[model samples]
Target chain A: MRPVLIMVGREFRDGLRNRRVVGTTLLMAALSLTLALLGSAPTGTVGTSALSVTVVSLSSLTIFLVPLIALLISYDAIAGEVDRGTMLLLLSYPVTRWQILTGKFIGHVCILTLATILGYGAAGVAVSFANGVAEQGAAASFAVMIGSSVLLGAAFIALGYVVSVLVLDPRTAGGIAIGLWLFFVVLYDMALLGLLIADQGKNITTGVLSVMLLANPADIYRLLNLTGFSNISTLSGMAGLSAQVMLSGTALVGALVAWIVVPLSAAGLIFARRQM
Target chain B: MTSPSVRLVGVSKHYGTLHAVAGLDLELHQAERVALVGHNGAGKSTLIKLMLGVIRPTEGHVEVLGVDPAHHAFAAVRMSMGFLPENVVFPPSMTGAEVLSFYARLKRQPVSRNRALLERVGIAAAASRPVRTYSKGMRQRLGLAQALIGEPRVLLLDEPTTGLDPASRQSFYEIVAEFGQKGTTVLLSSHVLAEIEHQADRVVMLDHGRKVADGTLSDLRRLSGFPTCIRIGLPSGVRFHPELPAGMAECRDLDERTMEIRCSDASKLDVLRYLLDAAVPLADIEIAPPSLDDIYVDILRRMAAE
Candidate 1:
């Protein structure tokens, strides 16, 4: 445990010196501010207001941006060290391989979480100010959005670790990480929609669809923040599908938690089995 | 006598079909500096890694500081061990001090000592600067400082002085010598046989995953069976080559006033006495013994012949 903590401290220092923490924080903040400014234009209406509308836009932005950012930061966690010729030296220390992996995981997750909270928090404050005081229960739903978005970022962080450990080279791991981002963010929804259309409402049951959507961490994140509350689901545009899917709030959160743990465990195992 | 710092008993490691290290047995005592010389694929690096417990051997046993390398308790051994790999790159964004502190923390050493280590390795001024701004030799010095953390009892250095200039290399050896005097068992691998010939207390020659030779410099010279040459220079304008020794070989004149005689290891003094007894109008006599390079080549030749 001491070794792990030492490694975590080192990794965190490395992140700060590299300016990854600051750069990512700034980027998340800027994008979220833009989404909030544009997303809050329809507040004070009969339908949705600042908090719920911001949640909708922020969730959409997260699907595109959070995983991409997480992958960008974490895809080289192991492979990059090996390429730069530091892995062997680091391994020569008394610490075990699992400690190094866990340390790096903790450090990178800290960076991403910092970026998520501060970035989204700034936008949340800005949106609340623009709407002339937030409504009742809206602040609670907004908190849930920020929290679930962090989970989304963590799930992708673990997935990036899987890519980093399994791939032999940093360049290959980087390419595969981008491919993963495209598959999950852009191509996955299109492919699922295609599968639904081709089914012609015959073979693709609602149960199958729910399972399929839950398989993607981004979708699970969306379900967690966008569906449970009324104002969020109405503006999130997932009310019809949410009614059909039929999942409690706990089950959706559990699925996202599994996404973070399972891939992280696999990465640790692969790193342990590896030669370097 | 103190127990060996490192001991390998019939140890071998194979990666799939390729034998990285064949069945081998070797031991390194405390304060003993051994140079591991070999070709590119001769298993020197693998052997170092095996002793460091970075990789487990497939067959037989490896005992480093009295603990099997594969054991969980070997971390205690590692605390007293330092390693500088052939290519060691510190994280670029970290300051030199930060890098040393990072390694110091991981090594479980007192962080306050890191500043002195940086000063010891002559990188103190650059301690506050990021490592990316460092040159190759400076980076290597930083690597040495990290390895010196906790003053490891057993140091495994693979081509450590590769990028160091001559002066830096000399200081590096001085530091290593200081550590050696304090009872650090140092094993460094290098392809340049001449550089470490005088530095190492003993030399171990490896050939294609096998230990072909291991001994002190004089022991190796005696074992290699290479002849030592005695060159005698006659006085100016005196060209009489008068060497009447039957057993001595290659007694011939090279220039107007010089004669050379080659003799076996056992008969070097005998030939010298015969030349002196003959009173061969000599100017000066020089005896050239077999060098470590010659013994190493001879050992490799013998290994290949088998």
Candidate 2:
């Protein structure tokens, strides 16, 4: 346990010093803050709190950006270290493979958490100040959005670690991570939408659609932050889909957690069995 | 023997049909410094990996500090073992001190000592500089410092001196020698036999994934049975051309005043007696025993012949 904590500390410090991490943090803050300011522009007439409007816009932005940021930061976690020969020296330490993976996972998740909070928190705060005062319900949904964004990022980070551990080549892992990002965040939703339109409710029922949405961590994230709350759902224009989908917010968050755990565990198992 | 700090019994590691390391046995007692020598693909690195538990052997057992390295509990033992791989690399963005401290934390050693370690490796000046700015030699020295983090009970260095200059190499050996005196079991692999021949207390030669020879230098010297060269320098004006021992020895004239004779250890006394009997004035006689390189090449040749 002590070794694992030490590893976590090292990995966290490494992430903090990393140029990519710093750049992504700044990018995340700038984009989310811009979205906040721009998103609250029309909220003056909508009568909803500025924070709730920001939540709707930020949830939409997170669906596209958070996973990309997470994958980009974590795609080379294992594969790059292995290629650089640092993995060999690391494995020679007293720490176990699972400990290394755990440390990296916790550390990367911490980075994503910091980025999501600071990046999106600044936006939330800015919108609150701009709109005088935010409603209690809107602030609650906004907080949930931030928490769920971190979950969404964590799920993708774990998936990226899986790719990193299995491939043992940073370039290949990076490519695969991008492909994963596209598949989950963009192509999967597009394909599902295409399938739904083609099926025309003849075969694809709401229940099946709900299951399909739950299959993707990004969709689950979208479902949670966009559709979980009635007020935010109405503002985000997901009220109809929210009513159609029978899944609960708890279930969506559970699926996202599962996404994180399963891939991270798989990475640990494969890493343990992998030769240095 | 203090219960052999490292022991391998009939260990084998195979990758597909290629035997990276065939069934072999080796042992290193406490405080012994053994050099592992072989050509590329000779399993020197594989053996190190097996001992380090980075890769499990396909067969047999490997025990380091009385712990089976392949088992989970070896992590505890691993804290007491240090390794420097063939092409050691550190994170380019990390400073030298950061690298040492990171490894020190991993080994559960006090990070405060890392400054001294960097100083010992002569990289104290670059301690705060990122590894990318370091020369190849400086990085190698940092790798050595990382390996020495906790003053491991067992040290394994694979081609540790590759990028080091002569002075660094000398200091590297000096540091390793200091560790050896304190009861650290050291196993280092190298392609340059002459460089480590004097530093290692014993030599283990491998070929085709199997150990061909393992013994002290003199033991291998005797086992190889290669000739020892005896150079005799006569008085500056003496013209002596003797040595017709017929198959017992071979003689060659080096210059006008020097002659060289090669004979097995068994026939060395006979050749000297014959020279004395011939009343050849021997001014200065120098006996050159077979170096580790000669014995290594001879052993490999003999193995190939077999």
Candidate 3:
């Protein structure tokens, strides 16, 4: 535990000194503010009013920017240490490899959580002020978005860790991690849409979407947040019965919880046996 | 008569088809400063890794402070052991103080103790600066300081003086000497035989992943049988009959006044008497014993011949 804390402290200090955490936070904040202002412009979309625009912008940022930032922050966690030769120095201490991996995971999660809350929180406030919505609903939406974003971001970060441990070179680790994100974030959605098109009017029910949700944790986060808004719940319903099944209740929360645990545990196991 | 600080019983390590270390046996007693001398592929680094529990031996056993490094107790042993690898690089973002503190915390010890260690190793002033800004020598010093964390009972140093200047090297040895005074067992690997010869109490020579020779410097010199050469310059116009001692096998007169004798028994004072009785004119005399370099070269050559 002490070793883990030491590693965490070192990692946190590194994150701050490298300006990666700050830079990422600032970038997200800028994007969130831009999205909020644009959403207020009385645009020509299908019913994109001030409130809907603000909510959609926050949700979009949570879906896209959160996982990308998490991957960027954590993809180099292990391979970077090995590349710089600091892994040897760290290993020479009286700590196990498991401790190191866990400590890094926790450290990265902390940084991600802070950045997510602050970046998305500032954006949430900006949108709420622009839309003139009641503070209560806006706060609730902000809480849900940040909370689910953390869960989604943690899954991606652990995935990055798995990539980092499996790859020997930092650049390779980063490349593989980014490639994985592109597959899940962008390509997976396109593939799923194609599968729906091919299945055309068939019974693409709740089970199929549930399985797809399990395959991509990011989709589950977006579905959960989208389901929260009254305007998108009907569209989410038509997407699949799995969307309706997961809209509210134990299954939805349970599936999201599984998203956080399974990948992280696998990463931990891989890290335990890794040579470096 | 304390137990050996480190013991390796027929330890061997294999990487796939290649045997990095094979059937090695060694014992490092408490406070013994032993130098591990070898060529590049002699398995010196592999042996150190096994001792540190970084990698397990495929055959036989390795025990550091009587604990098997492959076991969980290896952490306890590691807490009391300091290691400096051949090439060391710390995290670029951490100041030297933070780096030391992080390691100190990893050892489950205090950072306060590392302050004196940093000063002793001669990197106190730069402790506040990030390690990336440090020169190679300063970085090496930081490594040395971290190695000394928790006052390790055994110090494993691999080419600890590689990037050090002459003054830094001298100061580094002084710190090592101090550690030895406090009963720290120091095991160092180096290709610089002369420098190690002055510091190590005993030398272990490795060639081709095997222990070729291990003993005191004098023991190795004796085992190699490379005789010490003594040159004596005599005054001009001094002539004497040439009858030398038995152990002094080869004697040659190089110039009009100088004679050189290769003597196996370096302590033989009778050679002086012979020269005195012969009425030889002695201008000046220079005695040169078989150095560690000579012993090392002789060992390598003998191995190659074998």
Candidate 4:
């Protein structure tokens, strides 16, 4: 346990030294602020304030942005080390394989957490202050958005590890990570929309829709953020999703947690059996 | 008797159909420096990995400090062991100090002690620079520093002197020799026999994944039965090659002033006495046994013939 923590500290420092933490955090924050300022429109009467509108836009932004950031940062975790021959040197020390894996996982998670929270949080605060809306419920909604976005990032980081340990070549791992981003973030939902459009209501039931939504982490993040709050749902225009598929907040969080745990455990098994 | 620092019994490693290591049996006693001499693909690295427990043997047992290396319990034993791989690398973003301290912390050693350890390897001047800026020899010395961390009882180095300059190699041997004096077991692998000839106490030669020869220098010279050369100088004005001595196999003019003679071990004395009886005025006389490299080549040839 001591070694594991020490490795985590080392990895954290490495992440900082390489500017992984600072780079990702700044990118996410800049994009979040851009979306927040432009996301709101001036209507005669406001159904919800600028804060909920920002939530709507930022949630959409996270789906495209967070997983890409997570995947980019973690896709080379194992394979890059092996290619550079550093993994051989690192292993020659008295450290265990699992410790190395867990430490990197934690370090990447910390980077993603910092990126999602501060990136979204600072932008969210600026928008609310400009809009002059300070209700407690809006704050809670903002917190949920930031928290679920981090979980989404963790899910992709875990998926990245699976690719990392399974592939021997770093370029192959990079190709796989990009492929995963396209499938989950862009193509899966687009395919689901196409299916729903073709079914025209009779065949594709809401329960089936719920299960399908559960399969993609981005959809889970969408479901958790857009529907969990009424003001957010009204502003994001995903209010229709809540009408058909019903899931408790706990279920949404559980699904995202599963996305993180299952793939990471698979990586652990593969890494343990590997010779290097 | 105290347990040998490293031991192997009938160990073999087969990669697909290629046998990396055939049945090999060896034991390295504590504080004894052994050089593993073999050509590429001759299982020198595989044998080192087996002793380190990174790869399990297909046929037999590998033990370190009396504990089975293949078992999970060897992790504790590994804390006391060190390894310097043939081609080592560190994270390019890390400075030399950062890299050594990273390994030091992992070994449960005091990170502050790395300053001196880095200096010991002759890399202290560049300790604060990123590893990417280092020269090849500097990186190799840094590798030595990391392997020497925690004062491990068993040290396994593979081609440790490959990229070192002469002066750095000199310091490297001196450092490991001091460790050897303090009861640390050092097993270094290399094909250049002369580099380790004077440093290693015993030489273990491998051919086709098996131990073809293992012994001290004198022991191997006697066992191989390779004839020793006795070169007697021609006295001034004596230009023709001298007459043959009893038990001398062949005599030939080696140079302008010397004749070279070869004799079996049992007849070297008789050959010397015959030269004396012949009233052969000699400028210089020297007996030369087979070099380690020659013995290595001879052993491999003998194994192939058998």
Point to the candidate with the largest lDDT: 2
lDDT of 2 by residue, B234-274 (tens): 99888887747578998888998888999998888888888
Please, what are the lDDT tens digits per residue for candidate 3 over residues B1-306?
888999999988888887888898999988889999987878988888888887789899999999998788788888999999888888787899998988888888888988898888888999999888999989988998989998889999988888678888888888888898899999999887777778999999988778989999888988998877778887778764468756565788887788887777554456766766877667887877788888888989998998
TM-score of chain B of 1: 0.93
- Candidate 4 residues A1-276, lDDT tens each? 877887778778888888888888898889989988887556226757777778888889898999999999888999998888777667766677888899899988987897677888889878877878644577888889889898999999999999999995799999999999999999999999999899899888878999999999999999999999987887677888787789999999999999999999999889877776
Tens digits of per-residue lDDT for model 4, B165-239: 888889899999999999999999998887888889999998879898999987888888788889988777887
Where's the lowest-lDDT run of ten residues in candidate 2 chain A? A16-25
Could you tell me the TM-score of chain A in candidate 4? Answer: 0.96
The top-ranked prediction according to DockQ is: 1
Residues A1-276 of candidate 2 have per-residue lDDT tens digits of 877788778778877776656777788889989988887887767668888888888898999999998898888999998998888888889888899889888888888888888888889888878788777688889889999999999999999999999899999999999999999988998999899999988999888998899899988988898888777888878899989998887888889999999999998899988877
Give fnat, all candidates: 0.83, 0.81, 0.66, 0.60
- Model 1 scores a C-alpha lDDT of 0.87
Q: Per-residue lDDT for A6-96 in model 1, tens only?
A: 8778878878888988898899899889989977775656656777788888888888999999998889999999888788888888989
Top of the candidates by TM-score:
1
Rank by lDDT (best first): 2, 1, 4, 3
DockQ order of candidates, best first? 1, 2, 3, 4
Give residue B269's error in model 2 in angstroms: 6.1
Model 1 alpha-carbon miss at residue A262, Å = 0.7
Clashes of each: 0, 0, 1, 0
The residue-by-residue lDDT of candidate 3 on A145-180, one tens digit each, is 778888888888888888888886899998998898
Candidate 1: DockQ? 0.74
Which residue pairs come into collision in candidate 3? Answer: A206-A242
